[model samples]
Target: MVSLICTLQDHRDDVNWCVFSAKLLATCSADKTVRVYYTKDFSELPFSPLSGHGYPVHCCSFSPCGQYLASCSTDATTVVWQMDSGEIEAVLEHPGRSPVRVCAFSPDSVHLVSGASDGTLALWDFTSRSILRTGGVADTTMVACSFSPCGQLFVSGSMYGDLRVWNLELKQLYAEKSAHDLGVTCCQFAPQMQKGTGGNVVQFRMASCGQDSLLKVWNISYTPHAGCKMQLLHTLTGQTAPVLSCSFSADGQMLVSGSVDKTVTVYEASQGTLLYTLSQHERYVTACAFSPMAPLIATGSMDKSVNVWRVEDGCSTHEGKFLPGEEAASSCEGGKMGGHSRLMPSDWSEDDVSSWLRQEGLEALVDVFKANNIDGSELLALNKDALATDMKVESMGLRSKIIRKIEELKMESMCTGVPDEYLCPITRELMKDPVIAAGECWWSTSGFHDCAYEEGT
Candidate 1:
């Protein structure tokens, strides 16, 4: 499902961030410069290597219209670049002059947010290039900020592992402290919006990766009368080391992450499932993004290289086909993806579990399961030892069959669209059934992807 297209070795230092617009791709580096490339052919822009910052650039983003690009740096400033000419449009200084670690443009492109190392956040009016509101948590570095689709709210993540929701005025509306252990590195809101339960509340989905080596998906629901609530949806453990960055595809169906493990991971955003763990980077994969113009991905690394990859239908690796930015952007409309319910199988009730057993022809155990009050969550925790010792199941054949089915269900919650890789949360992992690693231990171990595939499989 993922294949390397090319490796771009332009930056001399660590590639800190990478992003894409409709027709162009932009990358910033610790080398104190930003590079621009045409998506069609990966060619550099005429006025590229946009050198405006006095120090390393930490983040980069393109405006919705692709007319301007923004990059923030350790220089304690956020610079706006006129994309066509790569000219510096304005330099907005952070309120405290603390090194800005992250910046993001609002979905409407009218507002921008820059978070600093001093735990300060400045909201800017992009049109006037002026600061509008200043607020933040004390004593904690602000490392991440993302605006909800409605543009009425944005979320900020601190180095202390706290996730806070702020309104346009920069007032904290909600907070989830210790959202991640150790620290929170990045957070991004899905582009698409969803209506809340009963259709009155406005709901937003966000994905955050942290120093805890876990990537989590959360549902932030806001009701006009009730204010806001944050709920955890999934905790994805696909990376071996700290996850450095995470991004959602334009359609919000696919999610990709780069990690200190030197791997690029792709997932089904809706299900928190792992699709593929791409091990091509020689060093830590620090940045990753999906192109708004095509089913393509660009990953940047501490190895000082940027790798482009193509994601397509099925488990087979192939080159990516192109889609115009407009067409790709249009996919965000309706904000709904068919197939699969939002409530994952792990949330099934005891009755639901019994029904599923009947469907899978484990009817003989349905009464026993009902007596034990097994639910979807408990069902997923079942294992060979538990089945034999705890449940007293004597039939090895029945245990194996039940275990196989459980493995498949476990992967069904990892992501919306899972890839075909073994033990990957995608591709339904029809083959993992105790196959273990290929070329040697196929007779046992390793079977099923954890919840990550929801594409055209």
Candidate 2:
């Protein structure tokens, strides 16, 4: 029942990475541009694209507070932008002209750690807009870096599969270990947890994945004499192909990973129990992340698609429960009861087609139908097979008509800009057909109606 909430097709080439904040999602692509979209309404176009990178952008990260975004490209530079205005705040150029492989923000949101191709890790202090410290140089390039949730430590992974831990406060390397047989692709400090000691003290842990097809969790502890100690806790092995990315859920109780095998797996964080294996993507899964403030996981793939999945009670959603005959009719070829397939039935009734479309959450297509002067109720009443024939016969002319109508509507709306007060506080987007409760704020009618209904407002 892990239904796809939506698929974003804005990127023209392979999507390398995607990151989510409280309200926005930032996706960087081989198209040499970064597109930021509202999480609530994927149908809306990006406010503007970030386009200064001369080469394919490798990675993008948001500040802890979601006020800024940092992206590194093969152009040997990193650009930081104001999230609200999309204005470049700083452009960090590597003196050696080596591409930055990855970048991360400190838990305090004041410092940025970047790993570069020259085997160097640089810590930049945003307040000064300059490099504060640089260390952890290896013969091979650096691949990944992550700041611990406690803000006391940071970790970096090298192309040689070595993992290095550094004390953020002291700005010095604290520990180092050979982590993987092959190059380490991703490393992340798990969300803070209180592992009860015999007394009342608590310890922390971290996780890393590599091209060796292994995921390792490490126990982190502090000692007066040794300063910091990291011990191998668990080794997770299920993926047959190289593991590319991993993420810890908001509660730190679960972990998810994507790999070159075209699958996403969810795991129990502590004992590494496999929970669910989602095999929806058609190509190598490149990136995966858990939302900080919601029970959602977003994954991007080499297939040029982004999928959002709900992570709760075996990935079931309220809207996914099927009625009689609905399951078989909507099931794609080769799709299991809980899986998704691209092949859909062609001889479906209009109601079946509409329900299938709604289940797939194709908001853009729904918008197109609304803009084309087609009656929503009537469209839902027409036979899908007939509609398919009409579409094939008049494809180009129908597309042109829909485009013109959409453009006309956009111009009309532009002439009457939305009132500032009616915008959603979280997304800062205009509320369409807003509905308000007694003392609560107004929300868009289509997207957030579930929240309001759940609250019994």
| Model 2 / residue 184 / CA error / Å | 0.6
**Candidate 1 residue-wise lDDT, 317-402, digit = tens:** 11134543443331111222111222355567887787667534477788778877888768877898888888888899989989
Error of 1 at 374 (Å): 53
* TM-score of each model, in listed order: 0.70, 0.66
Where does candidate 1 stray beyond 4 Å?
A: 314-321, 324-457
Candidate 1 C-alpha RMSD relative to the actual structure? 17.8
Candidate 2 C-alpha lDDT tens digits along 1-457: 3557778777788888888775678888888988887766755334557898999888899876567789998898889988778999899876577888898887556578788898877778765668877776758888888887645568888878888877654355454557888788888887663333422223567888999988888886642223456789999987888998888876577788899999998888889998889999999988888776556788988998888887655321212222232332232112121121121222234444344444433333554444343442334233444344543324554445344333322222111224535445544334444555445554433333211323554
The lDDT values for all models are 0.79, 0.67
